[model samples]
Target: MDVQQPLALLGGLSPAQFMRRHWHKKPLLVRQAIPGFKPTVGRAALFELAGREEVESRFIQHKEGQWLLRHGPLARRSLPSLTTPEWTVLVQGVDLHDDATHALMQQFRFVPEARLDDLMISFASDGGGVGPHFDSYDVFLLQAHGKRRWRIGRQKNLALREGLPLKILASFEPEEEYVLEPGDMLYLPPRWAHDGIAEGACMTYSIGFRSPNRAGLAHEVLLRLADAAVDEEASPIYRDPGQQAVAGPGAIPAELQDFARQAVQHALQQPLALECALGEALTEPKPNVWFEPAEAAGMLESVVLDRRTCMMYDDQHVFINGESYLASGPDAALMRRLADERRLMPGDLAKASDDALELLSSWCESGWAHAGLSG
Candidate 1:
């Protein structure tokens, strides 16, 4: 992927240009972003995916001046009448299930993998919408089918309506409007208020980015760092002076506070601890995701990794599905290539040494990856 090369996906701008000119700064509407774009999964198939426990889904119905929202595992019977307009079913993380959707998501890889979240597909009837709201992360809204009317603006007032089930903006002000047909896409940065209402039967694909809040990030990273520190067998006990006299039982010892702070600092001081934690955090499977254990048939000279797998690497380590492995030499190079390409060709697999092959075999057995004959 050449960051400087112009791409139709980025509205004829190179990724470098897009990043510099618009990313997290303004909005871009790309006409015919995906020429001849169509839904990869049919309505029934999408509904079936929504019924699965691992897929996050929701249904929204707006009718007779009333709005209703429901979480899914929804049976088709539970859905609003398709014959009537103003109903919708949204399935999140379509990229994790469909190969085509995953391929579509790769076009945005110029952004950091950590920020690249998942694709969500919304199937809506006439007038269906989730209401006006703002997202904390950037998003690319691609119209897949039918038509949708979008009104957008830079929102200054962040006030929300109280007592509503949804966090809808209390007062939405629109400065721009566009009616999108198939293949039209709108890119909006974080906090840009927008609302999309279906003009008729419609399907919209949202490529949403992740924006981890600071406190939430710290909590996850600290937990991971603590686990790694414990694994290192470095549990040092706190010591107190025997001769020290306490005026009150409620008085906290200053030395103990300093010791606790030093402990936290020490854990964070480990080389690349933050990087490792970040990789693990990004690859952590959603609650709905689960993997079946791969059956071990026999030792293989080579194998192909699973498409659902998220593999990434940095200078010192390789991360796959929240687990990190030390990276070095030819094996490291091969693993890094696999992460980038999302597949190991026969030629690449042939370069793997016995040690690397053994590790890959273990991964296959654990269902983190899959095995295949050289093609």
Candidate 2:
């Protein structure tokens, strides 16, 4: 996308302008972000997805001053009556299951793919809401159906109510409010408290970004680095030919500690090792995601990545579904395009080398990508 091109989705701001002015800095409320928007997944379809064991879903109800929460797969029979006020069903990762929902999410690709997370759809009855709460990551809440009254504030008191299944704010202070109709959207940065209550029966689509914590990122990258190093030639074992016996055998030896440190440093020292590991980890499929096998695609006219497939690239490598491949020159450029656009046209595919074509064919066979143009 052209960064300088203004978009209705960003409320007439160019992507560059929006990112500079609002991202991680303040809230942005865009009226008619998607003109004439309708719910891509209907109520019945959403409930069907919630019933699937592979999908992550939650059922919440606030009734008579009592709150109830339940995890799914929640069968339709288990749900409250449609007339029941203050009841909600949240289905996570809707993009992974529906084509139109995935296409809706692609509009937000102005942000880097690494930070772009999944889209979640929440279906609710009259006056329903998940309560006032703040997210650790940024979110774009888009109204899909009916109307929702949203109260937002810059929360200073981050304390949560006790003995609750949800982390609801104990003191929710509202500074501004709006009633959103279909196609309206509100963007909130991390830690900005907000509450949305349904005016009637409604559905909201939440586009969330991933904010990987430092410790968690380190844990995953380090583990991948270790796994990558396992196939390499072995490093030397610790030796103490010149050392004297220690007074306490229970204590870790200083030489052995140095040896362990050196081993880690050696692993990190490999060229592009850190980058490869980080890329692979970021592209890794979520635990609940699975792909269907496909027949081998011998000749590719065009190809599109599976919606569930996560693909990314660096200067030196292309990463897809937790695996990495060395990439360079024109081939690398082509792969980068594929990652950015999630599809390759026939004209683009004609430039691929035999090796790249073979690799793409193998990906098609594995269901990571499709053999033809996606509709």
Candidate 3:
């Protein structure tokens, strides 16, 4: 995407301008984020996806001053009738199941693929809502069908109501309100309290981002580092020559404390370990994701990554599906292009080395990518 060029998705704000002015700091309400947007997946089709075991789904209902929630592979019969008031069915990771949804998600590729998560579809009946809740990640709620009434606030007190199945705000004080029609969208920053209620039967598509917490990131990085450390170092267990007994048997020994600190230092000191860990972590697919191995894609001319494939690269390495490979020279450039654009033209691979071509063929056979997909 041309970051400097105006995009209707950003309300006529160029990507660079939008990022500079509003990204992660405030809300952006675009009147027509996608003009004349017709939903690719209809109500019946979405319900079909909700029935699949691999798809993550949820049902929420507010009936007679009570909030109720349920998990799914929900059968169609289990869902409330279309005429029923105050009920919703949310299907997560819709992009994984529908090709058009995946294509829809690509329009937001102005953001880094590493941070861009999946699109979720929420279908609701009249008066339906998940309640006043704040998310831990940024989100763009795009109204796909019918209408929704939204109330937003910059709340400081992040308290939840008692004995509720969902995390609902105890005292929601809305500062602004809007009724969104089809094609309208609202972007909210992380922890920005907001509520959306269906004015009638409506469908909304949520484009969300992945924000890794500091401690959680540290844990993942350390795990990756440990795997590297085990392969590179095989140190003997500690043994003290000078006999010393501690008065407090429960307390850890001073020698052990020093050992622990040194171990951490050694892990951090490994060359390029942190970079490798981060690349691998960012490209790792979600737990529920699975890929079917492809039979030989014979005589490939060009290729495209499967929608489910997660590929990324750094200065020294290319990472995919929790695996990493050293990449350099012209081959590195070729692979990086594949990661970024997600497709390679015949000309793009004209100069690739035999080693690189063989590797790509292996990827195609493994179902990570498709062969002869270039137009």
**Candidate 3 residue pairs that clash:** none
lDDT of 2 at 324: 96
CA RMSD for every model? Answer: 1.9, 1.7, 1.8
Candidates sorted by lDDT, descending order? Answer: 2, 3, 1
Sort the candidates on TM-score, descending order: 2, 3, 1
Q: Output candidate 2 Cα RMSD.
A: 1.7
RMSD of 3: 1.8
The TM-score leader among the candidates is: 2
Candidate 3 per-residue lDDT over residues 1-375, each given as its tens digit: 788999999999999988888888999999998999999799999999999899999999999999999999988999999999999999999998888999999988888888898999999999999999999988999999999999999988899999999999999988889888889999898888999999989999999999988999999989998888788756656777884776888988788888888887888888888999999888888888888888876666898998988999999999987889999999999999999889888898888899898899999888888889433
lDDT of each: 0.86, 0.95, 0.90
What would the per-residue lDDT of candidate 2 be over residues 25-56, giving only the tens digit for each residue? 99999999999999999999999999999999
lDDT of 2: 0.95
Model 2 TM-score on a 0 to 1 scale: 0.98
| Higher-scoring candidate on lDDT, 1 or 3 | 3
TM-score of 3: 0.96
